[model samples]
Target: MRKLILLVAMLAMVLVGSVPALAQSTLSGDQGANPPESDGGSVRGIITDISGSVVLVEADPSASSGPKGYFTVTDETEIARLEGDIRIRASFEDLEVGQQVQADYAGPIAESYPPQGEAGSIVILDEGGETDREATLSFELEVECDPPANAAFFGFIPAEGGINAQLTDPDEDGVYTGSVNVPKFPPGPAPPGTEPVSLPVQIVQVRGVIKDFGEVKIDGDKTFKATVSFCDDNGGGSGNGGSSSGGGKTLPNTGGVLPITLGAGALLVAGGLLARRLGR
Candidate 1:
């Protein structure tokens, strides 16, 4: 009985002692299991907030709606702030709220709401940065008709009363062309406690219609067609529909850790049983 108690005690000590080494090995393997960054995409928006290595970006609204969430920003991320014709290198500490910026990152971007991907590089847009034009962006379209149309019209959405403009086919060709200037920033006072208006990156739906008959306008007779595009030149940049990165956080492997813990517990239970039997 004494020998039995000694054997159980020795077994428990051996198993318990091995637990630390097994756990350490398991943790080291987990550290290496993190996925590496690959060729990703980009996102441009204003920084609404920051926590740890993550920053919440108010990306341009799109047809596919989702909630705004946090994006991981890390030391490896290349950050820069534009200064009048020069791109000044920046760090994570320099990022601020309300500044319009663009982040280019590695992929494959996670398909979660308010999608996420790590930024390989970030550029802060100055007032007149290369891609930060505040001027009107123009749109053009052409239409086909039998007889030369007496009048043509074009329009886009999200505009006050909807934007409307007359189109012209100057060359007498059935193809008609027209353009509307949309400012990168909406003109008006921003709502109280809100950031300045940044143009939404959307599939701008443009419509064009031509009327051949003068006085009487017939719906069937008038040639109508629609065009759509994701305007990247405006608030949109070369990106994965405005996404951020949370790729750094990966779940650790518990396979090895679990066994180590279980073995230790089993050994302790056997030792207790042996000691209780000896006491009896």
Candidate 2:
């Protein structure tokens, strides 16, 4: 009986030692983990408001339609990086409250009632369609030209049609500098005569009156025009105060034409007189 009891204790000790090894192997191997590819489709939403880790977003109705219609934006670190007030292409711009936008997203689905929310990220795709996405429709107001030493002039109000854009002048000069966040608009179906659709930034010529200046109120609105070159990933430069038709403009070379002709005529007359004198 004593020997049998000893043998039973030995067996228990061996089993305990082997249990840890089996657990380690399971953890190192499959470990019952789900792959990331299992998550399909994407969700898009706007950051309407932020409360702690919860982000209230007004998602696009067209994208979120059907059974999984409702979508909300949560305060996830990954999602915050992609948000700005106006959705400009390439440059970081703000999105206005009423402005429409699209978001790309993907995550896990809930299995229980009330639908437990899944974690995911979102990126701004588009603001509105072509008619709304033109550059000429927007305006950039210069607040101040001369900033304080080492300090830049800040704060410019966005007009009714445009979104609020902040400028950061690194040189501390009055020149306000900043990026505008534009939306990534999707391509439409190809028309019969048109070539296959490709994504390109739309260029526009802006023509409007400067309703108001920075914090300081100007006496009257200033009428001006500028050309905006914009694209999904990049945009560049502004040319203002010009007519669409290239006309009535004095070209550089035209000024010299009259002077050269007069000089040649004068020289020819002088040569004729000199020849008469030499012949006599």
Candidate number of the best lDDT: 1
Candidate 2: Cα lDDT at 102: 41
TM-score of 1: 0.29
Candidate No. with top TM-score: 1
Tell me the whole-model lDDT of each prediction, alpha carbons only: 0.50, 0.36
lDDT per residue as tens, model 2, 59-141:
44244222222234444413322222322222123333333334333365455321224335434444433333222223332
Collision count for each candidate, in order: 6, 17
The number of residue pairs in model 2 that clash at the backbone is 17
Off by over 4 Å in 1: 1-40, 61-70, 128-280
RMSD of 2: 20.8
